[model samples]
Each structure stands twice: as C-alpha cells, then as structure tokens.
Target: MKKRIVSLAMAACLVLSMMVTLSACGGKPTLEEYYNSDAMQTIITAAVSQYEAQGVECSVTASGDELRYDFTIDIQTTEEERAIYAETLESQMPADYQEFIDEAKSIKESVSNETVTVVVTYYDADANVLYTQSYSSDG
Candidate 1:
C-alpha cells in the first residue's frame, strides 16, 4: 500500500511539472513587445516617411490567442490617394515581416479627407481575423 501511494505521488508531481512547462511554452507575445520590435517600428516609420504623412501611430492588443494591430496615419488624402497609400504601406512591410500583414485574419481600413486608419488583426497561431472595419472618402 505504501509503494502504491508513493507511485501515485510521483505521477502527480510529473503531471504538475508538465503543466508548468506547457504554460511557459504557451506564453504569447505582448503588444508592447511587438510594437517596440525594430522590424515592426521600422516598417511603420518607413510608411509614414514614404507617404509624407504628419505622423503614424500604432497600437497592439491581445485577447487570449487573438492579436490586433491598429495603425493611424494623419494625412490629407483623397480617395485615390488613400488607395495609393494603402499599397505603399503594404510595400513598406519588410520581407521578413510580410507574413504579419499577409496572414492577417482581418484587415480594416478607414480613410477620410484628413485621417487614415488601418487595423490588421489575426489569431496568434493561424493569423485569422476576427473583425474588420474600413472606410473611404466615398463613404
């Protein structure tokens, strides 16, 4: 009976250790870490400079396994200009980071005469979008 009890305890300890290891491996990237990464910030700065926009702002939020990127650019742009800007933004994404944009689960873009907003969100593992919102000068 004592031998059986000792074996059970050993099993429990093994299970607990496995749980801790899995939790550590499951750690997701934080918004701040993503935003501050040199690769990500460089792409944003490049887009802002290419468009000659006033400024570019970025935010990242996560819920469970979902990750979202919200970018706002201040610029006076017409409908046509907005389209071009969007293209330029995509092009500015670094080769190594293109997967982030390409694999986005949902992409939402909004443009007005004075401001442009782009929100690209995706699941952490598969890059699936949950929600999207976009606007244009025509609307």
Candidate 2:
C-alpha cells in the first residue's frame, strides 16, 4: 500500500510539471495578435493625432511582422527645399526616434521573442517620395 501511494504521488508531480511547462510556452501572443490588440490601436491613434496637429499626415501599418510609418508633409516646396529636406532626413533622425524604437522593442519583447523592424518613409506635398529610413531590433 505504501508503494502504491508513492507511485501515485510521483505521477501527480509529473503531470503537474507538464502542465506548468505547457502554460509557460503558450502564454505569449503572436506578433499579429499583439498588433491587432486594443492597446496597440490606442498607441497608434495617439501618434497619428499628434502628427496631424503638426499639419503632417501620418499612418502606421503592419507589414509581415514589421511596422511602417508614413508621413506626408503638407506644405508645398521647391525642388531646392525638397533636396535640403531629404539631406536633413538622411543626416539625422528626429529627437524622439530612439524613444520610439525602444518602445517598439519593449512591446515586441513583451509579447513574443520575435524581432521587429521599423520603416519610416517621408512623402512630399505632391506625394513624391522624399526619404526613407529603417530601424531593426537586431541591432
């Protein structure tokens, strides 16, 4: 009778350990699931509103585990001005660029172990592409 009780206890422990392992592995959401979550939508909406207040049209979209930001300048500019703007974009990023990247990485890590890439594209007033840049979590 004592041997039977010991065997039953051991079996129970094995089952409990398996349950724990499965739960730990399945707790994290996929990239697409997190991207479509309400919390992510709130972040995107706030960002869009802030850019709109500055007279720039902005949008965020998901592209195969990557995030894309598109910003359109509202004011018309001459070719020289556009050239200068493009040069500036290539030289330096906005002050909040790093912050944005950090937040993206943090959120992605929290949801899953997958890495994320962020792409930024700037458009002129006439819808012509002016500049493009990308940031990756791998670095």
Candidate 3:
C-alpha cells in the first residue's frame, strides 16, 4: 500500500510538471497582436496627447513592426528654417527621444523578439515635410 501511494504521488507530480511546461511554451505575440493590444493603444494615446498639449498635432500608427509618428507644426516656415531644423535634429535628438526609444524597446521586447523600427516625421502646417528620423532596435 505504501509503495502504491508513493508511485501515485510521483505520477501526479510528473503530470503537474508537464502541464506547467506546456503552458509556458504558449509562444510570444506576433507584431500585429502587440500593436493592436490595448496597452499599445494606451501608449499611443498618451503620446498624442503629450504632443498636442505642446501645440503640435501628433498621430501614431504601426505597420508590421514599424511604428510611425507624424507631427505637424502649427506654423509655416521657410526653407532655411526647415534646413536648420533638420540640421539640429541630426546634431542632437529631442530631449525625450532616447527615453521614448527605450520605452518602446522595452515594450517590444516584452511581447516579441522581432526588431522594432520607429519613424518620426515632422511636417509644417501645410503638410510639407520638415524633418524625418528613423531608428531601429536591431542597432
């Protein structure tokens, strides 16, 4: 009777271990799933609100693993001004740019192992492209 009880207990333990292992192997989310998740939407909404509060119209979208940010400035500017803006961006990214990138990478890593690409485009009031920047997690 004692041997039978021990064998049954071992069998139960084995079954439980197998169940745990199988559940853990459920697989990571696809890029589309990550983008369409409520968490991603919340992040996008917050970003839009932050930029809008600063008088810039901002919209964010995701296609595959690429996240795009479109910002429209309220005022029109000359070609010289656009050139200067682009030069400044090339020299130094925005104060919060690295922070934003880190956050995005963290979120992406949590959901999938795929690379995440971020594209930011700035536009004037007339929808003229001012400056554009791209970043990739693979870097």
TM-score of each: 0.33, 0.69, 0.69
Query: Residue-wise lDDT of candidate 2 within 77-135, one digit each (tens)?
Result: 78888899999888777765785687567546655647877788999889877888777
Is candidate 1 or 2 superior in TM-score?
A: 2
- Off by more than 4 A, model 1: 1-54, 94-139
Instruction: Give the C-alpha lDDT of model 2.
Output: 0.71
Model 1 lDDT, full chain set: 0.41
lDDT of 3 by residue, 53-110 (tens): 8899998877877778898999788888888877876677677578558755754664
Model 2 misses residue 107 by how many Å?
A: 3.2
Error of 3 at 4 (Å): 61
**At residue 44, what lDDT does model 2 achieve?**
67
Best by lDDT: 2
Q: How accurate is candidate 3 locally (lDDT)?
A: 0.70
> In angstroms, how far off is 50's CA in candidate 1?
18
Model 2 misplaced stretches (Cα beyond 4 Å) = 1-25, 94-97
Number of the candidate with higher lDDT, 1 or 3: 3
